[model samples]
Target chain A: MSSSTQTAQYNPAYHRFTLFLAICTFLLIVAGALVTSNDAGLAVPDWPTSFGSLYRIPPMVGGIKYEHGHRMLAEFVGLLTIILAVWTQRKEARSWMRKLGWFMLLLVIIQGLLGGLTVKMRLPWYVSTAHAMVAQTFFSLTILMTVFASRRWIGSTVTLTRHPDPGALSFRNLALLTVLAVYMQLFFGAGFRHGGLHFFPHVVGAGIATVILVWASFSGILRFGNIKPIRGASIAILGLLVIQLLLGFGAYMTRVVWGKDAVQPRPSMVATTVAHVAVGALLLAHCFMLAVQAYRNLAPAAELSPADQKAVVA
Target chain B: MKFRFGLLLILLVAGCSKNETPPASYKPEAPTAKIDPSTTATVSGVVTYTGDVPKAQPIDMSQDPACVLGKVPPNFGEAYAINKGRAANVYVYIKDGLGNYSYPTPPPATLDQKGCRYVPHVLGLMVGQKLRILNSDPAMHNIHSMAHENDGWNESQYPGGDAIEKTFNKPELMIPVQCNNHPWMKMYVNVLSNPFFAVTDAEGKYTISGLPPGTYTLGFVHEKMGEKTLKITVGAKEHAVAGPAFSSADIK
Candidate 1:
């Protein structure tokens, strides 16, 4: 089948909306990071409400600005996710895509619950760490959905069947491994933030994840540079990796070196730490996107089962 | 001879009456000794530091403009609160030797958040004594107690909000209380079983009075200097002086 045949199920508006939701999710991650960086997780004290009222707007002063603002943005993104899921279910032709839509909804619901639990339990390390991990998962799912719905993804499916690359499977494996490494690193980072894990684990995980990410990105560029989706994602991940490392160092300096005697959370500390967390989320999402693209567009058709083949075309 | 016999019989009867047991309703009087200042002992001490004091670092309250609205930003690196050679904010308490004597809870202690700082940074209160937290600044504050032995709690207080009254049910030494909104606002609450504890003032002077005369382990705790203990014997109506000298090497 040609690209045009596969394009029938692709909705341009839905594709754009998915991308928009993904961006919003990234922003929400930033806001959430701000809350942690400022230690404002318990500023509002109540879950699902600011100062015991759902409708009443509490004065956004001090930590409330970061915490309550994060909640507001989170609610907006939740609404967006709901619309995206419902729209996908009603309009998408693929059963797997519809399932994915519902699954994303479920993940988002769990993410919100984790958020509430983190606050209600007064920022328990486990719950807060879970909240951070789930957020990254939900964000990665959004990115995956966006890539799957793109025009590039539709055209690549047809093109890959005609010209099969034997190294595609290895590349896909490498990408997946990079995803796991990055996700584990993020878990350790979140654990460190919530005081569940020590800083040593996070630091060690960062080094290992960095090596894997660099190797995977280089492999994608060297072997599959012609593939736009794979190359683009690889480049994005590489760029974000650099920025992440620098932000990580900046965060460390502000939090440990310069802030050693700080009486309060300094603005620089909050800024650097929040940016580091935001960039880390973006890096994870992009890494997952690369893995998905490699799996769907680079892998040989013979390796896919009949169901997988049908889902790919659909 | 008859009168002498009568006298001897009378004397024998009196001696027999003295040897007889008392009535069932008869009870002896209670002891008059109590835990009064005149009868009890006082522990007076000065916490002195022999090493160089850490200089205070200027706090950056620019994150919240309300924290520095009209007042100058304060420096806070001095974790030991050393002035001249004396240490302020040192919690001096009778750590041991009060065997079975129970004490009533003291009056409620007040901790205020003013200028984005905790007033009376180190406080000692008896177990079950109320702690009234007030926000005197125009900024919002959340009091988060990081208690290990007691139940931890976090509550928000808006600007000009009502005072938050809390009581610790267990004896927890040095429970850290922090304002998450204003991270610089920190305090340590010492929940003690007895009322014989005092925090050193600016001059490093502390007097723990009304202590029953006995040998005790006087504990001196600082936020950064770890802890030091002294063995002292207190006599009735005596003022026992126990001065603990902390060195910079003791900083932990």
Candidate 2:
């Protein structure tokens, strides 16, 4: 069968809604950034309640706005995801997308529960990290949905011929290695972020990720005939890693500069933290590309080139 | 086979029962002494930092090479103070005489070691109360009580193991709870004279009750803070006194 026949067709409405969800997810991330930076997570001082009341009322109450506002936005994002997933259920095109949609819906709900648990548990580090990670994972799914639903990637296959070289196997291995390294590095980064094991480990993890990313880029270029997208992603990864490293250093050096407390927030501290978190999201995207490329190459090609197009296959 | 099975079942039940009993004993105990409900009075006030709540020094837990190698271990939050005689955190409460009234019990307390620090620098317990002192990290910790006016004991807990259940025999103004294994791990347990009294919050707020409707002198104190006295009379309704707010200088 042709690849297009075997592959699930893209649903435009579903694609649009998923993109919208992705946008909202980004906003929620930014809002969460603000919340963490401001230390507003505990500002309201109660879980599922604002100052002993169910909902926040305006003008006079402090902390209600930031805390409840993040909550309200989170609920809206959850609702959007549920709606998108349910709507796609009828389409039933790609079983994987449908499954992922349902999974995303379930994860979003669990993520909310985890958020409440964090408050209930008084911000235990592990639960808090899980909550942050679930958000990142959800964002990745939305990115995946956007990619699969797009006209460009749908029905496409990666081939060793397109990536043809004596080193196709090594390039493939390098790609898989890149994903594994990035993932482990991301996990360490998460630990450092949540465990509050600041500075040194973060630097070490970033430095390792940077080295692997550069090695992977050089390996990809040397082996894959200089595929621009892969090269570009590697370059982006390097740039982000460098910027993230500097931000980590900046977070330490300029920590007391704002003087909220040596432990508390300064503008620079807030900005750097948000940047650090955001870059992790971007790094995950680059890692996703590495995995996708590897998966595509593993599968047989359906679209024949000009030379092979005329031949009738047995 | 039948005879062996019977013996194994018997052993299993006995092992499970005894293993469960010890952890159940971890629950905190309310004071044995009680005050008459009719006589109980309440004293409450806000604690606020007027000048400055002295900035806590940042502990570079990573300062030690052993910590980086995950050997000597690091202090998670604040390390022990070397020269400072007055401890920063000591929650003083009454060890006895609080009439029974419904109150939210404190969260199951923990002394989690995260990235090598003991959370909650001070833990408050009633004189007859039980405290669950937990060790969260993978490091071995020995909880040592340096009690000046009360019985002192020290014990160690292995990583991922159960927290030790400890109680105080009598009231103590303040006692230093240290980790002998990790010198930097230090906490304070304040044993109260009356179960009715509690340390004020960060805002300097406290409530005391279960007093007979008569004038009694109540003292407000913290580890680093000196005593503030107030005379209170409880009528049909509980009495309230605005806790004395002191500048950081006044604390001395």
Error of 2 at B190 (Å): 5.3
lDDT tens readout by residue for model 1, B190-235? 9887788999999999998898989999999998887999999989
Per residue, candidate 1 scores C-alpha lDDT tens digits across A17-76 of 999999999999989999998888887877787888997887777778888999999999
Best by TM-score: 1
Whole-model lDDT, model 2 = 0.58
Tens-place lDDT per residue, model 2, B1-252, is 365346434544543453354322222355444446665566665544455555554534332233345545322243222122323332434333334334333434455654345667666665556677776665544566767565555454556678777766566665776552343455677765345556544434556555545555665555455555555555655766654544567544
Relative to the real complex, the DockQ score for model 2 comes to 0.04
